[model samples]
Target: MKKKFSLLMLMAFAAAYPQDVKAPDMSSPKWLRNAAISPDGSQIAFSYQGDIFTVPANGGSALRLTIHEAYDSDPVWSRDSKMLAFSSTRYGNKDVFVISAGGGVAKRLTYHSAADVPTDFSPSGDKVIFSSSRLDDAASSVFPTPILSELYEVKLAGGMEKRIFSASAEMAVYNADGSMIFFHDRKGYEDPWRKHHTSSVTRDLWLFNTKDKNYYPVTESIYEERNPVFAGGNN
Candidate 1:
């Protein structure tokens, strides 16, 4: 009983006067890209040096996740924050790749030749939505002469890909209920290098329904409205 009491007192004293420990060395010359917050709001996932990494949200040494020769960018977190979906060119093509949030070997999700850039995960966390420029052969559609893009979703376990929106959609995020998706759209969108030019190529915000497959305009104006996000946890 006396030893137990002493241990308890030591624990109490430590809690009362905790020591500040230094974080891990995070110094790196490589550029950091595509940083994402975990679902629980504890950690952040990012891509650096052609690989994926996770670091403490506050400050600490980052944990490296993926190590590959191919370039990996645009890390998107699952709703549960246990997994991350990113785009990699390791398989000779830019396709979606999923990896554990902690760190591990990444699994390829998409195998198409077209570049599939992961944009967001479904609210249910079962499907991952991405943007692709490769045209779907089944859909007899017509896009701009050179550049064309659309939104698509694939299962986490890997299966048939589904087309969500048939437009030049970028960064499409789903609501909490997964009934609606909000994204920035600019079919044949102009390049950002054209800083001063204001043409019809300006991107607009649009909302699409997953159930009815109906889409409508949220905001349309001369000014470019891109990167639409939900606030208050998409409530």
Candidate 2:
């Protein structure tokens, strides 16, 4: 009887004095997308909660670069690491826009009905290259379809956009000397929500020579390959 009474008194005392609870950390937000590390390897820019943010590559507090209500994503760092170009739906359809690394007014780079998604900045950082289905090249023999996208580049100063490649090139980037481009070809569209299945229209990586205007397949696998990149200065 004495032991039971002591135990009950201890339980009552513990229930009366609860431990302190810590608050949840909101710094590391979830569902971060389109993360791109700067060329200098100092900072990382990503899309989180419908806005763009930059944080130290080593990990630290995140700095919000954009606070717009419209959906903004696809952050691409310039070669110099001083600027960032991203896609935004501020004007209805997705269009390419550029902002400073430190954050400021975003300048619209492309204005077209077709969605312009910035893939990478030019080697000289003078222009921003993007993928769009606006039009097929005049010399292109492929049929006109929305599934296919063409590569186009608009000057940072903002002028007429010149079509660089007439095929469906995605995640395209230039080599060190700008002599070649590495990208993956999108043959056609597929239902992303459907179950994964192998098909003949799987994406393949390709290397394109700027001088000859010719492209060669880097991978001929039956499975899908994507986002090709050059490593260690080797073309």
Candidate 3:
């Protein structure tokens, strides 16, 4: 029942790129991922070395935010760009936390037993969408594999978390207009190299319409596409 570590889990999510794409320069210390621009589009917040960091949008020195030993990543700027919300394991479990954009004490947002990782913020800046398995009955099962990770929204100021949809998703991100959410679901599969060894898996993009309360697949191919964000805007 233990969670299976597939390629998707290690790379975070699968993104479709041209087959001729060159491998990234992993040797450079400045390489980063999950780059989110500020609302004003003047700066970017990203994760590096297990903590969140910020740098000028035009490229400059990076400033470290959290100094905790636990893993911290997936940083997103609030709509107003006054604060930052991200996921961290500082509290002994992966949970969402918010801190001032200018740097200050971080505030814990979710208290779930499992993991609550915020993916993106609504355009209005009133809510945040995240993925978690906190509702699953972990104690009742032997291996406690994350059977399903549903998307939920909680007020940026803090309040009751409401389930937006129940599905086996990995990372969830809200669209620019806040009318829809895109996520990646773990489509279970069997290990090809080892016979009789089933493993937790995922591949496919799912779009959830907030207005209609419906979920549907955007693509049927087996590719991991995740951490999607609205590109090109006034910021």
Candidate 4:
């Protein structure tokens, strides 16, 4: 069952990012997606072929981690670069999991039967933030949903998850001070014909302050903006 779901996820992803995915050059054979630099900026980790792998920042042989038959992707390195947090479908449902950066057994961190995708790690490396449908009261089933995906944070040692925002967003990056998180928001629709349909998909960047519990638009343009990260300085 877990293996089947993994295949399904890969199919969905392929449909979504097919144009963006480029065939690897012979010199570098791996087709990488969602590559993120470790907090220290020393190494980079990314998902490829349903697993997480890391390589040197300057370039080197990719080291594979988490070999489960189920899907594993969206790898985020801890602040110290000692552990990696990512989402996997190995437990028969999409949930967040963590593993040592060097390589080790992946431990499940979330138990939502619905999808859970880890987006970022806090600056302190004590917690992980992800998007999930688990908190929806009407979402008894995973696939069909009127409820939007919300942002949540969970302790690395494992504990109750905390809801931080109510919006369907993706590719979140934390502020250096951990006071705010930036993400791209989008709405989904059932109708396939409408040009501006929910599924038509327009995204924009947003910033949510953890302390004030408020969300602010970061971009005014209608064009889809995604994966915003703080370049330098403490915010």
Candidate 5:
């Protein structure tokens, strides 16, 4: 009789919770991610579900920075710590955008058809660097989309974008005085589970001279060494 009662309870529990369903809290305030600290170290910016938020660096209630139906993430702060640059799909494609660090309406910066992910702020903090495949030479024969990427910069005050670097250079950042740049020469550097796998396609660190547009390898290992930035960061 005890065995029979236990079996009945098990069936009831199975019926209450289905295996294929996701929990309601999967996309809530508890799911904040992609956090970045401000240049002055006073605040932290993060993404929750599909919105962007800012909270005190010392820990406090998070303040929502973006409230929209589209997803916004990958936030980077400007040097003066007065503005934040992030990526958003609000315009149908992921593009560069900026908002007040204190919280306000976000302004779209990039309008390319391809994905434009914000990498970092310019050394002067007057512009933002983003990685994308907006070049004319990008491979399009692939069934879905091209994988090659390049870097570009757009003014924070809003203006035309300027091509910074050519294909295969991404997740790039500038030094304090904008005299040099640290970046990776790989397209799939963003893949989450690519660790311990070394090959000819592995991402390597490269330091670029902004003045003469010359570059040299910082790391030549087959292992991944992408997304190079300063200790405290250029911005």
Candidate 6:
């Protein structure tokens, strides 16, 4: 019987490849990073599973901010705690994007080909400070490297970005009045997250004065120092 033989073949194929597949467990998420608290200290934003999320600082249900398939990370809150600026790979490169604190459509800020990562928002919250390896000075002779990025700022209303500093300064956070910036300086190629290993390649803390364009060393310890943020009252 030809019909009987066809049914047997179909049964064998179904048994070989099952239709149901188990989904990944999300009960306990691990490897969440780039957590930052809002200026008002009401909620905390962070990156997990290639998306941004916010949870109450006092411990509560987490709110999903981004639901896109693209990779998004580094949620930096605005000074007023109404907006968030983050880096996403939706447009081929890591470009800066801003979204409301309550979650909504995101607005693209930077359109450069190089990766742009948001470091902090301006004191007035009209512009966002980011770091990118876009270009260097025409007179400089140093070789180009992606690890060495330059600081830049883009308007929140959307426009061309302006270069702030031409050097490798990562994870930079602004002071209260935007007069000074506390950031960690990179000397050479080294794993930023590699801890407890002390060597010459370790990163150091520095304070950059916006008025004088000068750099002041904050720490000279052999241990690695990264992600320096200004506390209350210029401390």
Q: What tens digits encode model 5's per-residue C-alpha lDDT throughout 122-226? A: 877788998887664445332223476777889987888888867567778778888888888764535635668777778888888889978888898868777
Model 4 compared with the native: what TM-score? 0.77
TM-score of 6: 0.86
Tens digit per residue, CA lDDT, model 3, 69-159 = 8998989888788889999998788898998888889988888887887877778887877888756433333233555576788887888
Model 6 lDDT on a 0 to 1 scale = 0.90
- Candidate 2 per-residue lDDT, tens place, 107-211, comes to 998989999999989888899999999888787888888678899999999989999989889899888878888999887677523445468778889988999
| Clashing residue pairs in candidate 2 (N, C-alpha, C atoms within 3 angstroms) | none
In model 1, the worst 10-residue window by lDDT is 137-146
Per-residue lDDT of model 6, residues 123-191, tens digit only: 988999998998976765656788888889999999889988776789998898888988887777777
User: For each candidate, C-alpha RMSD in Å?
Assistant: 15.4, 7.7, 13.0, 11.3, 5.6, 6.1
Cα lDDT of model 1 by residue, 62-168, tens digit: 89888888998899888888999999998887899898887777888898888899988888888899988766445636654325678899999898888876777
- Report the number of backbone clashes for model 1: 0
Q: What's model 3's lDDT at 97? A: 92
Q: Give the C-alpha miss distance for residue 108 in model 3, angstroms.
A: 0.6
Model 3: lDDT to the true structure: 0.75
Candidate 4 residue spans exceeding 4 A from truth: 1-27, 136-147, 190-201
**lDDT value for candidate 4?**
0.79
Per-residue error at 83 for model 1, in Å?
Answer: 0.5
The most accurate candidate by lDDT is 6
For model 2, the superposed segments whose C-alpha errors exceed 4 Å read 1-27, 192-196
Q: How does candidate 2 score on lDDT?
A: 0.89
Per lDDT, what order, best first? 6, 2, 1, 5, 4, 3
TM-score of 2: 0.86
